[model samples]
Target: MYKVIFRIKGNQGNSFKELRQAGFIPIYFRKNGKDEYYVTLFRGKDLGEVKEAILDLSYYLSKNGKYGDFNFATIYEVGNSNLGKIAGGTLGALIGYYAGGIAGLILGTLGGIFLGELADIEMGEKLVGVLGWPMSISR
Candidate 1:
């Protein structure tokens, strides 16, 4: 749950690639003005390494003369994406069983999967969008 929190300003598409290379599984990251985001990377318990990645990213950005302010670099232990998805799916299946019998179960599970996937922070910053979870950025 070593969740990396940061924001990108305007368009810097290559940052996503660098982030992936930093051992972070991209959950949801896209070009935007500025917004806090949680990536699927923070699996380990080492904040030093996480901070290094952030520093590396900052250095990289500085080299390219991109957005210069990499502030509020912090680490967080966020909820597991797989666990959250499974819970969502299971809850969906249960609700489906009550709503439309077997068909509902299938539909609900599928819907749940989609919702779960959307809920996936592994794909990049998607958690904030799907669940409205406030960006856990800290200094």
Candidate 2:
């Protein structure tokens, strides 16, 4: 998966709608105060395709003069790891077995699994390897 982060100027709602209409789904969106917004989109497509899609959208939106200043920062290849889940489960089982017998063991295992999944997701997203910086698209 590739993660693309960019900043845009205008109503985020409409921009997001336009993006969806263009077949681009945003994974994350944030209001950077005022008319500025930060949008993060994830795609499994080729890097060139992703860039082209965004460029085309920016161009289309820019013509309206309501959406412009689409500045892209970096594109990263998202990484995945199962180590966290495995380690968490094992540790939880051990601790639970020692603390409260069978009941504790079961509860602890479930809790640990949940936490592990969260850790996996959070850490995995952050551990992304940089694919490359996308060329700035000028509208």
Candidate 3:
């Protein structure tokens, strides 16, 4: 399975949704000292299709006059501004996971590999504060 992790500087929530909707499953975790989000395309029968779909999105954001130059910074800023306030809450967490699931569906539509036997996608299982304090998160 190929993995691509992009630094999200925005809403850890909505961007989760957007990415999920794109079919790439969201797996949240931490490494070193940074919080990380991973989106993987492993179930695809066609790697080229997956790559193309993601590239298409990137291209749309890059050349779409109004949203042109949309890159990591833009994604981060938007996600932060919109989803930042939803850091902690039972319902918020559910919403985040749902977003991830929907993204998986979207990815399916875009011809990714998140299908049938490979539909296992979800958010990370942790609720540490920005300070990395351990918190309880019940499934």
Q: Which numbered prediction scores highest in TM-score against the true structure?
A: 1
Best by lDDT: 2
Error of 1 at 128 (Å): 18
Which is better, 2 or 3, measured by lDDT? 2
Q: Is candidate 1 or candidate 2 better by TM-score?
A: 1
Q: What stretches of model 3 exceed 4 Å from their correct place?
A: 9-13, 29-36, 56-139
Off by over 4 Å in 1: 10-14, 30-40, 70-72, 79-86, 95-139
lDDT of 2: 0.60
Q: Rate the local accuracy (lDDT) of all candidates.
A: 0.57, 0.60, 0.34
Per-residue lDDT of 135 in model 1? 32
User: What ordering of candidates by lDDT runs from best to worst?
Assistant: 2, 1, 3
* Residues forming the 10-long window of minimal summed lDDT in candidate 3: 73-82
> On a 0 to 1 TM-score scale, where does candidate 3 land against the true structure?
0.31
- Write model 3 residue lDDT over 34-116, tens digit each, in one string: 23344343235444645544554343332322111123211110011212223323334455456667654444333332221
Q: What would the per-residue lDDT of candidate 1 be over residues 73-111, giving only the tens digit for each residue?
A: 445545545755786789889999999999999988888
Instruction: Work out the TM-score per prediction.
Output: 0.53, 0.51, 0.31
Candidate 2 clashes between residue pairs 3 or more apart in a chain or in different chains: none
Better of 1 and 3 by TM-score: 1
Local accuracy of candidate 2 as per-residue lDDT tens digits, 1-139: 5555655565434466656654565666677554544445555556677666666666655654545432433555556677777888888988998999998888888888868865665566642322322335333
